[model samples]
Target: MLSPVSTDSNHHPLNGTDATEHSVGADLPRAIATLNEEETYRALLTATHWATLDHAYGSAAEAPKRLAELLAQDQTVRTKALDYLHYTLHHQNTLYEATAPAALYVAAILPNPRTTRTVDKGHNSFPGCMRAELLLWIASVADAVTDEADVLSRRHGFPLDDYPPAVSIRRIRPQLYSAAVAYVDDTDRPTAEAAITACIRLLDDPRLLHHRAALVPGIRQILGTSEQWQHRERAIDALDTWGEDSTGLEGQQNPFLFCDSDTPTDNGSRPIDTNEGYSEPPPF
Candidate 1:
């Protein structure tokens, strides 16, 4: 589902000077290792923000190669690389690798939940702060989408700021569609239905108003169910925003037993399991 960003894969749109020089290349591994010490880690995090804002493309291009180099000598460096790569992806929207031939393969090599470990430092640390901010952004956007484009914009329910800006919502729209389709097919009807319901909620996110074409078709799946009441209301709100159907009744009981409110209301319901586009308990 990830689309090619630019027609020209042979050329980079913009280039920056590579400041980190490895003269011998042979001594690069040892040098990078030495650079990863505590002070360097803090510097890296500080550098991350500036790189994200000003030089995202360069950082995204550089992080993976540096990661592979560091991973070869000491696996722990993978942690640092992953953190930086995540930052690049969230900010720059650059591909994992610059070359067309290596894009898919490199992307697949990304560590998922299985391989990637969360970097936590007590209650407050740079990475920790980043994670919290990223989560908040995701929650905000997810609560704002209005249709398929919004869902696409939100990157299949993942928050926009948590990933590199180089990877656009449009690029991954097909994957999001496939994921939703798969969610509907799973044997557990209620769970599958609930996920579809969540998709409706995602589209209702206010941030996605401009992308109505991508969101309207999925509305039929979310209509008239107490189970998905809140999502239904949001969907209705989105529909209203688009001048489709914007009316709401007070004290309506949602079939899914969800609370009715524009703001997020966590009722402590069962967790949604959305892997492989099917219904199953989360891998808790």
Candidate 2:
């Protein structure tokens, strides 16, 4: 589940490093359409010493290259890059020092028209856009730092805030949310649902509760028609936790299809469908 929505919906704990901004009167979102995508790719590489950080396999030296590869003209090259992000940087829903930093770049690239036209692998029909892959990959990272993640970290020795990577991940919520929220109304049905899922997960930080007010109707719209039952249920759970009225927003019954039940996962879950989450099959 998500972090319990702060009891005081208005209680934004902007303490030391946890300070989230109360600056916006109305939420404004960002998209790649508004950005220079080439500059974004370059900045991700130069933004940090990626090798200095760690991912599942070891030094995150490959993080920058893989992220750059996401934009390659060859579809296979791009899909492989996304696969690397899934299995390594945010491997099995575990966060690495590189995961959060790399995630910021991931957030920066949404609404790229190229990915929006691509279908993910394994689905023969109307599969989601490649942006869904990026959204859910970010979802995996955000899920790793929820209050639930806190339990795991405490078991190992530290609370999430004290963990360097978790703290970094928490600090970037607004940026990630910006990327997701802008897509909630996407024309692609699955893409809209994926965006809704991303927003709910990111709002676990009390500072983002304010966004709930604006998202309710759009969420209801997506879930209303969503066949992705697991993701749909989790989104409803998040709404209820935040004290929103989920009156008719219940999910589809269980015995869901393999991909439907296996997708929209959380906190270490690699939904069987998740492997198919990133790329559409190539045409002969």
Candidate 3:
């Protein structure tokens, strides 16, 4: 069930800055802080808005509902919400107009500290892996929207005026990238690893390249301290691929070579290739 859109003016605060010029780390939270969840949901999920948007299965009216489900208390419900998002918005590695809006909500939900905490005896109930999966989905949606916008620009010699949602996606990309970078040190291994993966995927965007200085320390920390070999390997790969200077680390002979060939690594199970359009296989 979708939450009712709040009509109160106080609930719909605006950050009062140009989205384009906003700084990364400070901008995402600021923009999110100003948003009214219900109002935003209402604006993005209406029939008039969704009538034009088409997902793999067709109409994307359910996107907002699924997005709302992400905030549900049950971990299973949250996981299903992510799965539905992947199936609909990003099915077959394809992006839809609804993808960007959905990505925004995903970014909004991620900053909550409870989302990344391990299940504990106290108030925290959501599983950390659910947050990790959401990070993967954010990266996938961001990558897909970027690819779509680039393709349109190359073909038309201008921005995507034909698709207004694509423009929104491009505009919000910096904030999305910032949110991912900010969460790189989340205490849970899965959440931190997924955050790193999102950062690596986002490097493909020129707007986020400037964030390299901000992202390096977290990547380095993950490479040096994370218990999961997958997290460490991905961080090392990101550093090497980006040519980031890892000189801050103490004496080490090619820290990049720390991972032996025999060590198994999980190449993030999600299928998020920009060039590939393969549909997900059946679970059987």
Candidate 4:
């Protein structure tokens, strides 16, 4: 099989969760007021023919079921199903035919906190709600369609277009950006950071350029403190691209700050980490 262009290597996570740490990020319920979470999820699911979509593997027919499991009453089921979706939707940052719609589903379900039971799902040591990880995955998908990535994909004979199992995921930038921007003010810092990263790349849609400045403050915030270098780096690039001054911002906080060994750390006392670097997982 021919390898296509890997546009953005900016954001990602994994398929497994460390059993020891289970930290939750900001309260999602507060972000969403009075919305019927269950009804909303069902409505979104009913409109899509998931069986006709495609992922890194095969048909996305199983996607709807896996996504519905996000609301499962069982913790193990929720986390495991989340992991499965991540693995299938974005294997190694190579977006598949099914990636876009699946991503839309993830974005659609953001308002519900009942689906957030996993932690340490991102490549960073950041402890957050499962929503944060989902946002980060969106970022990774958008990252795969950046200008540089497009050049590489073309050179590699993949062309990053709305074609087969190769590059169809590149054309839906505007829609994805629209869905992701809804959480830019999320109470969860990681989630907000992930959403910001996603919106920055998806802004490739010329129509969204005017909104770039609005996202600056969040980008600055990410650069100021995020443990994930990939997120921080993207923020810096975005600032430069948009002509925003990113003066004193650094690439990463001291991962060693108040830590022992090289294992890295998480939200204050938690010490939660996936031990993965900036690259990704089978689902990046």
Candidate 5:
């Protein structure tokens, strides 16, 4: 099969030898020839499709449009493209990683996270080839970017209090966190807090259990805090919802959820039933 022609390689310009190597291109004959083969064609096209999106090329919008056209007709291409997107978003190389500037386009064209999960399940070939990896990739990047912004806020002396309260933080927070987290494949202790927060959100929908296991430390910390008895129990309840075996701490079998979700009753053991009684959980 014909592989991706490096748009970065020198093309024999009609004028002469000194033309700068770049991503500008006409569709290569090799890519065209493979289109009839379905799977191979989809993989090849999706892998190289970003070439057309390069600003170094003349038509910026046209590349993604052509990609959408290919996606509409071929399920394989769409699956491959989405996975490719996750790869690009997470990879650390500045030349390849998705940039913050692309947020507008990402929001417009990317598949919804919830819907993307279903599409991921549709692509599996076997057990080890599970679909959760890509979704985790997305979540990772979103978390990373969010963390970076927090660092920036602290480093530059921007007060967290200055952030507008009415703004929907979750909507903006995930994309930032996702960008940063995408590059992290192995879980780290620092990010456990963010990962746990993400896992809880996913818990309302049970299917996330399989995927959430990797983030167990953060969840355990959330469940084990000692702020108050009731708050601690709620954390336990959340863990219980996931079931006893759901706890995956490194040393502990029945991991304790922390006191972050504290109740404000006299003993902190009682549920804070009234809005007046309970302090709100921090902005997720």
Candidate 6:
């Protein structure tokens, strides 16, 4: 396992327990604040860093602004943010120094209720579907990192040091994991499905797969219910993939094996929309 990166005295590592006990959304501001102070993060924010870092559009100068705009209240703004992220950070499955932090920011914002609210009263807003898309993008980036790392290790004939971007992600795995779990239970079907997809893709990383026991129950819950047909199918697909590689889980009542793809309802009825008590994102 990689050693935890050292942070200042005021900043604490976001372990699984802290994530469980506290709201991941509530903790995002502090996490971003702490990240801002890290040397590598600070470098990524600089104009010089953007000028030197290559992206699909030649330079990554817009990366920092786009990262900040991901928190914007406007649906258009957030969509643009996703576009910029997709075009630059991991364009064509290429990772950069900024890719990891970009992914971290994506994970940090996932559970923020402010980012998940649908548009209302003509105010610009983020939709649950968009948030779900962002989660999918996050999953893609994580999978790309694993693929790239493996290729490099094989070619170099030695285990490479943790890629800088991945190291940044490792520093906050607990927070990401916590947010993902919270998202899986989100009232919006697409958002929840997206979260499940993210969780499944993240399992591609060996470190995360090693901790699969903690996440398996949640995966089972999704697969065993009628939350959303598409979500359930995605969950089943992810579990099936993981089951193939996971020898330990063999003969342990694989949830995917018994899942009914054609039937939307399982032992329980379809989940009711329970948006009550949830606040909409405040207008900009």
Number of the predicted model whose TM-score against the real structure is largest: 2
Off by over 4 Å in 6: 1-52, 118-128, 147-175, 223-234, 244-284
Cα lDDT of candidate 6 equals 0.50
- In model 6, the number of clashes is 0
Give the poorly placed runs of model 2, Cα more than 4 Å off. Answer: 1-34, 123-127, 151-157, 255-284
Clashing pairs in 6: none
Please, what are the lDDT tens digits per residue for candidate 5 over residues 11-44? 3111123323312212222223433444543443
Cα-based lDDT at residue 263, candidate 6: 28
Q: For residue 61, give model 5's deviation from the true position in Å.
A: 4.9
Question: Between candidates 1 and 3, which one is better according to TM-score?
Answer: 3
Tens-digit lDDT string for candidate 2 (1-284): 12212221221112222112332111113224344657645754565667788887789887878887776777767767777787777765667788876776777667566666453443343344578777777777788777767888898888887777787778677767777787787777766777777787787776887778787777676754577667667767776877777777657675544545334454323344433543332121
Candidates' lDDT values, in order? 0.32, 0.64, 0.57, 0.58, 0.33, 0.50
What is the TM-score (0 to 1) of candidate 3? 0.62
lDDT, candidate 5, residue 158? 65
| Model 1 regions lying over 4 Å from their true place | 1-167, 185-190, 198-223, 242-284
Candidate 3 pairs with clashing backbones? none
Ordered list by TM-score, greatest first: 2, 4, 3, 6, 1, 5
| Candidate 5 minimal-lDDT segment of 10 residues | 1-10
Model 1, span 71-137: residue lDDT tens: 2333345444433433333222233323211221122222122222233222222222222222222
User: Of the candidates shown, which would achieve the greatest lDDT relative to the real structure?
Assistant: 2
Error of 1 at 99 (Å): 22
Query: Model 4, which residues run further than 4 Å from truth?
Result: 1-40, 120-127, 162-171, 252-284
Which residue pairs clash within candidate 2?
119-280, 120-279, 120-280, 121-279, 121-280
Candidate 5 segments whose C-alpha is farther than 4 A from its true place: 1-63, 66-73, 87-90, 93-134, 146-171, 174-248, 251-284
lDDT of 6 at 111: 47
Give the alpha carbon lDDT tens digit for every residue of 13-110 in model 4. Answer: 11113312212101122212333556656645555556777776678888878888876777667766666655567665556767765665675576
Candidate 5 TM-score over all chains jointly = 0.29
